[model samples]
Target: MSIPAEKVRERLHALRSRMEKKHIQTVILWDPDNQYYFSGFKAISYSRPIVYWIYEQQTAYIIPELEDLHAEENAYTDSFHVYHERYNKGSNDTSFLDPFIRLLQNLPSDTRIGVEYEVMPAYVYQAVLDHGHDVVDIGEDIIDLRSVKDEEEIKWLDEAGRLSDVALDASFRHLKTGMSELEFDSYGDQAFLQAASEKYPEVVVGYENWTCSGIRRSAMPHLHSSTRTFESGDPVVHSRQVWINGYRAENERTFLFKDQATEEQKKLLKLAVDAQQAGMQAVKPGVRACDVDLAAYEVIKEAGFEDYIDHRIGHGLGLSEHEEPYLRFDNERILKEGMVYTIEPGIYVPGVGGFRHSDTVIVTADGSRSITHYPRSYEEMLIE
Candidate 1:
């Protein structure tokens, strides 16, 4: 289990406390990440709804019969309201909401319910209204609590960081001149999956962003890898993310392909590394999140590449990949200890290649600690 029953119970206790403070009689969670965070049950809900409804003193999971067995063993709460096929053929009267309503049989009609409206499905939101329950948006509270990583969560984040670096090392070993981006990507994925499978085969090895090559088309950040082969000195902006349990971490490095790189290529890559480091250094308790972003942005801006900056420094990464405490100029949220996020500063020159170095880091009491420890120096990244 990703989170032990005791840990899950502890989290539930926290939620109950928040509910008491807010006068929330019940809190219904529809977001998969939220569902996974509180309960250990992981499932995507759209048609077949998987809900976690917690009242002041009661907690139960209204899940589909298909996942009943899994939830029985994994979920922290024992009160499961499992339902079979409620939508029989085209009968709208017997929709999945019917089963959900049954789960709330004990809930009072005037009970103040809390929900994550922004991420909750429209169908589920409407069902709550139809039931005429008093609902309040508790999205901010949920986001606030999730931003801070607990000890166990930090452990998984570290594991993800270690395995991701191993995968990148294997990819570099397999890399050669004239290799196509797609071919190299396959090898990189294989390495990541291999490392993850050895410990937990069910763990997912996937990237939130594509493994962009520094070749012609690779200058475009977020572009999918094509058949373009790496030449002698191509600067490939490689970024990857892997998930263990429910936590994820990313490791990105700009590699100098089999051939030697140009002076300009080396210069830009160094700047990117420096900018990323600056951003990471700016992370610590009490500092504003935007300061971290500005720290990196200033590095690029001072280098006369302000226009090359396209996106914010980086965002928070956790259960859903991108969470709150976003590192951006407009966001003034104070950085707190135990908050883990990514700092990726890049300059994407249209004609030339792009240079980006992303790392998952955590805010500490005194400073910051990088979970992703892959080498970022020009010497380590610039391969021959």
Candidate 2:
């Protein structure tokens, strides 16, 4: 059940309405996530510099001429503007900016244009400014609209959640003691690809397991592919994902070795889990984002482990790993219906390692829904 193109158009129309309210005649989307959110086309080439322009009447795309046919075949834009160069007698011809300038000329002169300053390059900014048009920063305005998910987006997110669950289940079932951290990570990686292929053929997965054991586990956060091997009592952190129909859902869980966790270690893990639950329960429409952080902070504080809380309780999650409307102590943004975020509360002690339990959640009309369903209790930590 992929989202229909017409629904994407409707969402863009709504965005155009917002542009009109802001007195913006055009918007240039340069970020890959924003491009996918507006165009419904997922291509890794989007990681490079690209532009998606939306005018009052139509949508346009400026991409290398090499990608022209593919863009048209995918219906990436209503109109395509291509850029190419001609080779002559040992000298190259055609400036890259020529096509961009030509496209700019088609737009109305003196029109107030909006650009995503955060992602747009400095040269692009200069080129637009050189065109004698009124350019305004509209990055925040665009992000505000994107922070809240629509009905269609939530459906895709739900599908992504189900895919992640399948991946995690397979990975956990394959776990074994004495395996190197990379070995365990390979199992999870293969599991994600296998699950995504069965569920959504268009999906692509990224990120790797942050598996660590023994002394390395004591680090606050781990990264991909280390040489550490899993010992009997080593705490393990596995971060995995599933990209369903181009939508991403992430989940991280901590596992304790069988009969290996000390009483203190077990207690700390429980506190971290409880704090994560409190944060999730605090999600609701109209609540301040900071309040969600407080929910988890209060719990950890009462347990006399406030100092171990090193990061924000959670953050906004969507197409990209991190997005807007962050759930942090300093962020005063109000939570609204259709917003999706993660609630990950962690406690880290230098010699004892850390415990983190995270789940992606969506803000519903009445309250909220946890998109992730992987087991979260100590009893469920038993991999074998």
Candidate 3:
């Protein structure tokens, strides 16, 4: 397991504290991240029940029978309740439900159970209700518990950030005018993976790449990479998240192909950079999360590009690129130490290209640290 045992214990301790505050006796966890968090069991959801059931005294993984041996080798928890068709060749519909019912019935009738209501499967919900166990929503609490990264998690995230910086440096070194969007993305991912293999043997990098060449196409956010070729004077909006171990760090930049950029393109890029800088400057231990967005958005407004802004400054990044406590004008969640997020303030003009740079940042007691650092100077961003 990538996470240390001490770190795992810390996570459990925090979870138990939260559970105690909410009177939650047992927790039914189905979210994969939570599964990985509680136990060192890692499994992709494939319609099979891969649950981590948390009782007052013990934690257990309920997985498919085929995965029983795998869980034994990899899972930190020794208590595993497995179910399979072969094991119950002639059993009826009760085959899958029986074990869960038995597990719940072992607890007292008044035991206050909590489930991730937003992500809990309907079958799981029915099983809890059928067993007469009191289930309450603990979705937000679970998410909040994961917002603060521990020392081990911060180590993995920092490594992920450096790997992402390696990827960005590779992409800029090889970027050219005639390459297709697919070609650029493919080459960039391969270079990142290769660099990670040589530099950090323990880390693996992967991402979903979004690339667009020319102003017309770059105006559309989340544009899928196609075979579109980059012209001589085109503006390239290239963005990707390089995931390490399961932690993600974003690396994105707006590039100009020719030696010279138009005045409007330069202005857009500077405005975006200034806005992003303002957002980065606002990150601290006690500042409101929305205030960071306002600090960035105000730059765009002052530059007369307020209407061009469509999305928030950024969102939380961890096992997933986008998560809780999103950096928008309405979210009032206060920033805290150990909370990692991105500060990407972009502007998309109607007939011009999108200009933005998204970087991974970790909030500290004083200010913040840019874990993923790449030179953002115009000289470093020119393709020619």
After superposition, the stretches of candidate 1 with alpha carbons farther than 4 Å from their true spots are 44-47, 86-95, 103-106, 200-209, 258-263
For each candidate, give its TM-score against the true structure: 0.91, 0.90, 0.91
Cα RMSD for candidate 2? 2.9
Candidate 2 clashes between residue pairs 3 or more apart in a chain or in different chains = none
lDDT tens readout by residue for model 3, 156-266: 788878877777777767677778988877777777788778876654456787887788887777889989988876778888888776788887888777655577887
Model 1 residue 192 CA deviation in Å: 3.5
- Please give the lDDT score for candidate 3: 0.80
Model 2 alpha-carbon miss at residue 363, Å: 1.4
Q: For model 3, which pairs clash?
A: none
lDDT of each: 0.80, 0.77, 0.80
Q: Candidate 2 on 68-177: residue-level lDDT in tens?
A: 66566565478866655555523231454665777788778878999988878899889999989999888887688788887777777887787677767776877778
TM-score of 2: 0.90
Candidate number with the higher TM-score (2 or 3): 3
Candidate 1: residue 238 Cα off by (Å): 1.3
Q: Residue 283 in model 1: shift from native, Å?
A: 1.3
